[model samples]
Target: MDWDDLRIFLAVARAESLSGAGRGLKLDAATVGRRIARLEETLGAKLFVKSPQGYALSEAGDRLLPHAERAEQAFAGAEEELSGIAGQLSGQLRIGAPDGCANYLLPQVCARISDANPGLEIQVVALPRVFNLSKREADMAIAVSRPTAGRLTVQKLTDYHLSLAAHRDYLSKSPSIGTKADLRAHRMIGYIPDMIFDKELDYFAETEAEVVGLASNSASVQMHMIQAGAGIGIVHDFAIPFAPGVVRVLADEVRLERSFWLIRHADDRRSERLTRFAEALGQGLRDEVVRLEREAAQSGLAPP
Candidate 1:
């Protein structure tokens, strides 16, 4: 079977229309339709059911989805490996991480990668949820939880401390937070449900209010809201450095720490872009942790 035909089918399947996929490939609709037909013939199965609405996957196509994806991924890695011999590391890097860590580190990481690998295109997937490496949702995942099962290549990336922070204005307006009780009296921004947060390390606990004034699934956005004076929120020690309007109120007293894991499928060792991106992330996080430790020491505040 022609690899391009399967790729053409995948594109059409995703786009849900010949015309849409055609526009993407800079081909006319007739060409797109012909390619899909050729692919279906080669596969000896109807991949899509054409309707007035759009093309939807057929039963055969649904079954072939995983196979198609794996084939493409393997082909990409093989091509990159050969290309790298000519001093070129070329492919897309798909990465997912929690909002807390991404807030400070993502920009610098992207800049460094782009500068070093001109042929590589980095696709940063910043979602409210952590992408599962075991499920192959991403090329690599920087997860709060350690991978328990799966053929995973996991590394303990770094530990980060969390602290209660708010805009300097909020502290000035509200009474000072000298004690835990003082924190209960003010408005607080908090994360929404079963997100990737440390529970045993006790980074988070039920506040005095038992409810939050504002909530978000994203730690970065929640931290930004706090800096925007939305309210005090739990933020990592590293996130605070980049936060403009925020300051630690009872910094000397409170802290929360969690481990970040750089994870990928063990099989992904063949992927050049994935491996390099993960290495960059691990090194960057370690460097940031050192910087944060220095800042915490200068402040005479106990590290969270």
Candidate 2:
């Protein structure tokens, strides 16, 4: 069987649609469909059942999935080994992270890594839910909480701060809040209760109010709502400087701390390229934390 055909099969199977797979492989839909047909003929087995819903894998396709994945791994390993001998890192590295951190932090780090290794490609997946490293969803991940058990290596990324905040206008017009008890009467913005991806993200425990007046699954959205004077909300301290008019509230009275944990599959621990990229990611975060501290001090927003 042609390895190229297997590659086409894997792409189509993962995408579940001819056009989708074609887009991923940079092939026209007709070509992708032809290749799948040829691959099925070569194997003398039906690999997919076509339907209006798109292709569903037949028994043969299901059986071939793991083997195809292994083939992909072997191909990648061979390429990495060749690249190592040439003193360069080449190929894709996907890093999964929470949406807020990805937006605020990852771009610069990814740029630095890519600049240092021109041949390397970086893919960032910013999601609210955790990345499944065990299933190879990401090459590495930055997580709010560390994994308790898995074939994984974990390390401290950084400890960042959060505090209650609101737009200047919101505070001006809203009820005064002198203490935790006073917060009860004001409108509050926060994460959607049931959609909170992790227990660590349930930041309301620090506040006297148990419910939010406005809620979102995205930190960015919550920040926007606060900036628009929808309500007071807890926000990352580092992000406050970027969103003008949003000011920290009760910083001295309420300081919330969270740490990012860097995680990688045990199998990737030995990869020099992965190690270098991970180190770069950590250094970038550390620099950002330092910058946040300086900005907070200069702006008079530092916590007591």
In terms of lDDT, which candidate is strongest?
Answer: 2
Query: How many clashing residue pairs, candidate 2?
Result: 0
lDDT of 1 at 155: 87
Query: Number of the top candidate by TM-score?
Result: 2
Error of 2 at 170 (Å): 3.0
Candidate 1: lDDT of 247? 68
Regions of model 2 farther than 4 Å from truth: 48-59, 81-92, 131-140, 146-156, 262-271, 301-304
TM of each candidate vs. truth? 0.75, 0.79
Model 2, residue 219: C-alpha shift (Å): 1.1
Report every candidate's CA lDDT: 0.73, 0.83
Q: How far is candidate 2 from the true structure (C-alpha RMSD, Å)?
A: 3.7
In candidate 1, what are the lDDT values of residues 134-202, reduced to their tens digit?
434567887788867877888899887777778877777776676777767788888765664544323
